[model samples]
Target: MSHTLLSSPLQGFTDFKFRNAFNHFFGGIDTFYAPYIRLNGKMVIKNSYKRDIALENNTELEVIPQIITNDVDEFLFVSKYIRELGYKELNWNLGCPYPMVTKRGMGSGLIHDSKKIDSILHRVHNESDVLVSMKMRMGYENPEEILDTLPILDKYPLKNIAIHARIGKQLYKGGTDLGAFQKCLDNTKHKMYYNGDITSVAAFKELQERFPSIDHWMIGRGLIADPFLPSMIKNNTTEYPKNKIDIFSEFHDRIFKEYDAALSGPTPIRMKMLGFWEYFSQSFENPQKTYKKIKKAKSVKNYTIAVREILKEAKR
Candidate 1:
């Protein structure tokens, strides 16, 4: 059996444009997880969400649509919507840690209540035949929260279960608890995918050694921080592409151009690229300096110059 590499979706960052551009430029991820589509207090699925999963927009990559909600109705609506678009799989995002989402008893917050999960899963599975997978944290308030939820989950014929080792409240702050994850490995019989803190090849190798049984891996911020990581892990090499910087430049330019055309002013475009630089700069030598310059660039022309300079520094 071979290892499977998956791209974990980041809400603001992993839209179709980014997924398409990343696939075109880097091409390591076996499947791209689109950001979770929510009803946003309405019953309608937004056009923006539809565009992200549109088959025509994502021709270059195998993409999975993720839906975030604790409501049975919302889940069913998204299920029918995507099935109409011809998608076979729908990923439930029970793992989002943000306060705004969790405050409403959604995302990781819902993981605490087994009964709620049981109700939601029962209705969605019975009402529609849409294949459902889940991406989640260990718990919202405690590591043991997942222990209680797994039995409820096991009752369902879920396609997959991807677990981020940290609890929701930790929110990417602390190291992943592999020990707790080991407990998860012991408890659940479902096919599992390990996620969180796999930023380096060495780290991934270490986890691979620790959990030889878990072949599926979901990468989120780490992929954003280092786009070449999946390729490195897949090929089992420390060496990066010789033209990595060049590839990154093309990737950045394409995303920039796309956002530039869609967005209104220099400010929105600059702000959008700045959000990417928050991660992309970490892949470079002088990350702080690189990010500072990019962050300070007021105009798009200046932002372009900053990027050029960063590329030059990367070459050196």
Candidate 2:
């Protein structure tokens, strides 16, 4: 079967600017899932969230909007909102493991309550015509939570289910439970996709060998850590471009320029770029030293210097 690769929704990093830039410079991802839109107490969807998933800005890539909400009303609201924006599909986020989200009985936290999952799906599927897919972890606290929830999901005509093989409590640490993922294949008839720890060509190949039938894959931090990873995986080549420095330099500059224009001051822009370096620094040969230099940069000039040094030391 032909394989399709997706860029997993990362709350801060995979915004429209990053999506457009990545597609322009390095094209491999079949679709980009937008970060989950959190509706405020006032029932307002933030303009920034609206702009991020707007079809006008995302003309170059196939994009799917994701929402993190346990409230059926909020789900219906977002569904109507996105459908109005010309989006045909919306992905429900049940994989976020952060405590703030979990404590609200949303994200992976909702996994422990199968009835809530059923209720939300029942209401949304009945009320909205928009196609809904799901992105989730095995469970929030226990590995078996998804087993109970999958049956509930099976009753709905979901577009697909993307499983991140670790339970929510694991966050991004530890190893993915391939054994459990194997069980997932048997439990449900819904089309399934694999997500998590796809950091290298070899890692992806290993998973492909283990689960050859699953042709859909979602990559998150790995894609940020190495912008060339998707292309490298598709081409089946471990070799990165010799001109990686120039290519990355252009990508970095575009993002910086966009953020600088939209954000208020140097500090906000500086903070934004620093967050990216947390994973992006891993792409370098001397990751610790590279990120340390970036962390110490108190000014934009110093930050630029650090970035230039990072490009000079890009892993060959």
Residue 146 accuracy (lDDT) in model 2: 93
Q: Which residue runs of candidate 2 sit more than 4 Å off their true CA positions?
A: none
lDDT of 1 by residue, 125-197 (tens): 8999999999999999998999999999999999999999998998889789999999998999899999998
Candidate lDDT values, in order? 0.92, 0.92
Model 2 TM-score on a 0 to 1 scale: 0.98
Candidate 1, overall lDDT? Answer: 0.92
Model 2, 1-316: lDDT tens digits are 6789999999989999999999999888999999999985447999999899888899889999999998989999999999998899999999999999998998999988999899899999999999999999989888799999999999999999999999888899899999999888889999999998999999999999999999999999999999999999888899988888799899999999999999998899999999999998898887889889999999999999988877776634
Residue pairs with clashing backbones, model 1 = none
| CA RMSD, predictions in order | 0.9, 1.2
Q: With candidate 1 superimposed using the best TM-score fit, by how many Å does residue 84's alpha carbon deviate from the native?
A: 0.7
